[model samples]
Target: MKRKHQILTIPNLMSLFRLCLIPLIVWLYHKKEMYGLAAFTLVVSGITDVADGIVARRFNMVSNFGKAFDPVADKLTQFAMLVCLAVRFHWILVPMCLILVKEILTGILKMAVIRKTGIVEGADWHGKVTTVLLYITIFLHLAWYEIPDVWSIALTALCTAMMLISFILYGIRNLKLLKNRKY
Candidate 1:
């Protein structure tokens, strides 16, 4: 059994810090009319989210609690930011819906795989790239103060493509792993 202290290590604590920043970001975006600053905050939080995983892995601190909490933290930040943006920008629904569906379905599949295989691969490389692209797209969209011209649209399209492709890749990888399992 894992020790209780391990569950609250520095990397996991950083993940939790990201979670705590979500509400402030949303509030700044909505109430304070500070989309750019909010977007910046989100970008910082995203970096921390990614960093936590690296820290956990580099230090061999991986644990069930961290595994479970990391994805939840990521999805919470994604959902919160997307939902907030969706409320103001209806056009965001397409990508937001795709993200939400992918997250929810994959989450369920991951749990089943864990139950059966007694292991999960965590987030793959494609998944990490997709997340970075999503963040870039979101930042571009939220840069309302001085919206970039054609590049924003291009990045949005690129982000959507990456997201869909990543979803497909993750599904295929996980399905293959599941199929190969003896249990």
Candidate 2:
């Protein structure tokens, strides 16, 4: 059990900042010329995300609110960036829809696991890898709007595959947790 959690911690504030960047990212994505600005803003958001985690752990400022809120911020940012990219890259929808299903099923399973195990499960390593791949794909598309068609498709496929893998792994873990729950 960790201590020193409070609502006003720096990590929570960083998560809040990331959440607030969504609209700007979306708007900039649409403007075309502002893609650079959008990419820069997204980079800042990503940096803040990494910093928040480091700050949270290093400072022992991890709060329940932050543990919940950080993932929400990450998901929203990814979703927003994907939707913005989907307009230009139709293949982006594959991961977007896959993530939609993944999140929904995982959300339900997470709740059941928590009820059975009485613990809020943190994200696993596969989930973190998927997140990184998703961000990389998004940034590539944004930063290199004219990226060769083949590369775009390849990256999208890779991101989708990673998400699918993580989805299955998370499902299995959650089910096992439910099965092994102490009654």
Candidate 3:
């Protein structure tokens, strides 16, 4: 598939909007009494994430820039939020670290795929599911402010499992693509 080089599409703009919301979310989250505000900002962030995807698909505005840029924005947002939460909830580190590792390995594989096949692979369903679950798990902690420990542990386990599954699937896909690359 030919890559769309367009950078100014609405979907891309919304992804940029999500990136812009991160520091604000983190700042509000750190404030002693601003959990609600922080949660609201996170909701806004998640909404924009969903909106961008819809706008991209419905309007045919998907772009090479967006395919790569959107996930970066998401990981940044997730990383910042996870760090903020880890200050109070140490268990947050589990998924946070797994995400860091998954992303690093995925990045290396993506570079290999691009070098060998000359294409950037777009995210598939497993990735989408993992992202959605991550957001939901994070948002739950942010929004509830008093989320019980049991719920926290369960959500973290679920999120970590999803990440692991996605990580393995992505590894397989990237390797398969590289193996099948034409000279």
lDDT of 3 by residue, 115-165 (tens): 888888889899999888888888899889899999988998998899999
Task: Give the Cα RMSD of candidate 2.
Answer: 2.1
RMSD of each: 2.6, 2.1, 2.1
Clashes per candidate, residues 3 or more apart or on different chains: 0, 0, 0
lDDT of each: 0.78, 0.88, 0.88
Residue 169 accuracy (lDDT) in model 3: 96
Candidate 2 stretches with Cα past 4 Å from truth are 1-5
**Each candidate's TM vs. the true structure?**
0.87, 0.93, 0.93
Q: How many steric clashes does model 1 contain?
A: 0
Descending-lDDT candidate ranking = 3, 2, 1
User: Model 1 — which ten-residue stretch has the worst lDDT?
Assistant: 144-153
| Residue 113 lDDT (model 2) | 79
Best by TM-score: 3
User: How accurate locally is residue 163 in candidate 3, as Cα lDDT from 0 to 100?
Assistant: 92
